[model samples]
Target chain A: MSEAARKGMKPKKNRAGLWGIYLALALIYIWAFSGMNLPEIKPTAGQITKSIFNGMFHPDWDYVSDPGGEDLLHGLLDTLAIAALGTFISAVLCVPFAFWAAANMSKGKAASGTGKFVLSFIRTFPELVMAIMFIKAVGPGSFAGVLALGLHSIGMLGKLFSEEVENMDLGPTEALMATGANRFQILWFAVIPQVITGFLSYTLYRFEINVRSAAVLGVIGAGGIGTPLIFALTSRDWNRVGIILLGIIVMVTVIDLISGYLRRKIV
Target chain B: MMNQPIKTSIPKPPSKIKNYVTLLLVLFLLWGSSIQTDSSLAELVAGFPNMMDLLNQMVPPNWGYFDNITDAMLETIRMAVIGTTFGAILAIPIALFSASNLIQNIWVFYPIRFILNLIRTVPDLLLASIFVAIFGLGSLPGILALMVFSIGLIAKLTYESIEAIDPGPLEAMEAVGANKIQLIVFGVIPQVAAHFISYVLYTFEINVRAAAVLGLVGAGGIGLFYNKTLGFLEYDKTSSIIIYTLVAVLAIDYISTKLREKLL
Candidate 1:
């Protein structure tokens, strides 16, 4: 500053680091893109676009409101039910596990580590894989979907809940302990209250995600809209596919708005 | 003193009735939905036997199947890498445009955010299936789907972080009469680069997991094997695939999480 200001000259920017990063990123991009084995874009692009657009504009309304058959409405309801039940079951099951996983609550590194490992193991399996396994167990229906979503949600919700517990104000907990309250009583009166709102917020967020997942779980015969969606696509029933996609979009949007509002109100 | 205290005006604590009402409503909804979905403890109990049977069948995994699936697993990782890289590239401009603190114009940020939200609403599976239809069954479609998904996620996360960054440097750049591009390059980029890299890595982690299943929709990946083994009732091979995928995912997650910890 002293030298440059006195000379009335602007200092050069030190851009070597930035340039290096850009160079590395460029190399990575080239390597990765080349490895993808991308197929050549077919000349049928225009036809596919036109067909998709046409179907979108003319979604089968009968399928939209059909009450007597496996229509968009029925599929939407099933997806909603799956997400709700899954979120509820997981949210409930997460409590005890979250308590065990929270470093503060467990009060031992070994116990908390074991709990974290269990959660990580559970989380490693994608909901789709879990759904496939549960389909084998419960035999291809909404039950399998619910169980799969519920179990997967436990991994996510439990981790989040334990983090919340770990970060909570310990003053109240200590005060309760000082008052000669037992561990369970302190947990109920002190710990649970502080984290309940955060727990609810996470559950709602997971529910939103589960709704989207439930839509796709049906592809593997785990029940919900995915079954109809995959079937329509496979059979080249563009009109039906359009309706299903539209239903999914609308349902997801509505859930997003509601959950977003609730999260803001709570968190 | 007691009489004076009795006359003191203390505002009552807000009633917890609202909380209880919401809780009850949520509980009722869960109950009704459980009934509607035909999910119950009884059914779960009955399914336990089947679950055990499946688990028993999977205990001795077909380790020989590892050779067959190795290339597919590599393809899955490659797809994630390429897709995440492409998405990170696309996300830069979108995040810049959508960041309220950077863009300032409501119209610009709002429209971009709407588009991002709409993209995010489509689940990765649906996106993969759609791309498969458009591009035919291959890793190309899977790559495209992951790219789009990563774009939505990365842009959203990056833009939010961009908005939260300190405004002091940006203001200083403006005071120095720096041009718009110069201001951003010298100010915003430096601040957000670390966060952007962290977000990119996180997206890669998610994409790896997502890509593993993209094959289910014929978009190409390890999911193809999942479908094959499950269709053939070869739980042993399925278990092996699961184990391999789990190891890969866990390794990536650990590395990325550690990197993110350092960045933050």
Candidate 2:
């Protein structure tokens, strides 16, 4: 122990690095603020703000549902559906990628390293960007959103799944090997069984995140509640916008709660 | 060959009923989702040729168009830097208040935590869209949106970590008759400083990604170019923008990750 601490007093802290940190921080702040013009409050900002608050307090209850057609309820359901399918597709597809990326599953670091690189590369593309790309291919609809989410989620899921594989107990693999089990057999019986629960929990976690993404995909015409939300935004229909925002918040919160509970149960 | 009973009986495996039920539910949800989204194999097949056409056009990215987006790309980084700094600054009080172990008042922490959670539910881009409505089309809305996003993320993580900080030091400080501020400065800050800094850095990384896409709603960033290129069917330019974004994001991620490892 330091002499000060040994004497029941405070030890002197190293402060040399603190000044450097402060200087760098100051420089960064200066650089950040130098580029842009100050923000202008829109002329209608006050009126719009008042209206938005009023609309939020008195949401258009009529927009909650319409007779057998698109409404808030359907919008929320479509968002949930997109999240569910996307999570499922990614969960199933990430398995092979996970196996490829897991260090224990590969013969050499090079193999797993390449797999890791690919996953990271995929991760850089936001699902929104992917949705745009898919809309070009599949047309602007909820299906495009699904494809985007499904594709984008593989990056995160593959990384998480691979880590789970790497952490799997090796005893069973060795025991099965001693019994003359084939490679696939060893993996199927030993690795798969151990990691399935972890994988499921991660998938549910991703599902929760996907719900938020799916809600906004409609802004670009990729489909879901976002489509209606964007329309409400453009039309300056404060009540409609308020209700859609409310729907999104409620849906996201509910899904997060359920998924979090399930994850806790699994893990 | 005979199916013979083992001399030493092994216990049967755990019930698979839960697994079976989960699998069934997943399958049903997938079926419903596909129908609801109008996703069909036939449509995918039909679209394959179009995708191939897009790929053919995208291979030769317009490297020359990089000049146009350079300013916007830098603006994106600037937005992230400012937003994350502002967020880290604001998160301190919120995090301190929400950390029940520190504040020791249910009434104080509970409402703060609830509002924090509510803020976290809205996506960053959605927040940007709202800010755009209020501030008009500019980087200000984007910066404000990212700042708000970073607040939710950083404060939540910071408070959680704060609650887990070592209590012995605080107790010692209390025994020394230190007041609340003194106790916090002498005890709490030292313990959580590294963690708080690391969380802020992590938020910066996420904000960079979010900021890049904020331009979609006229919030200002590289996302504005994404809309422009796509709207004009300039596939080549779109590819270049994507490439630039990827390189910038990856570079930042590498440096920030290294810094986090050192800090923590």
In CAPRI terms, where does candidate 1 land? medium
iRMSD of prediction 1: 1.6
What DockQ, on C-alphas, does every prediction get?
A: 0.59, 0.70
Q: In model 2, which runs have C-alpha deviations exceeding 4 angstroms? A: A1-19, B1-14
Q: Compute the DockQ of candidate 1.
A: 0.59
Docking class of 2: medium
Give a tens-digit lDDT track for model 2, residues A1-267: 888678777566567787887898898788889887777788898888888888888888899998878899999999999888888889889998998999999879999999999999889987788898888898999999999999999999999999999999999999999999998899889988999899988998899999999988888998889888878877888898899889988989888888888888888
Q: Estimate each model's TM-score.
A: 0.91, 0.95
* Superposition error at B220 for model 1 (Å): 0.8
Q: Pull out the clashing pairs in model 2.
A: none
Model 2, position B167: C-alpha lDDT score = 93
Question: A86-134 in candidate 1: lDDT tens per residue?
Answer: 8888999988889899998896899999999899888888889899888
Question: Worst ten-residue run, lDDT, model 2 chain B?
Answer: B3-12
TM-score of chain B of each: 0.91, 0.94
lDDT of 1 by residue, B79-163 (tens): 9998898899999999999999888889899999999988999999998998788778889889999999999999999999999
Off by more than 4 A, model 1: A1-34, B1-17
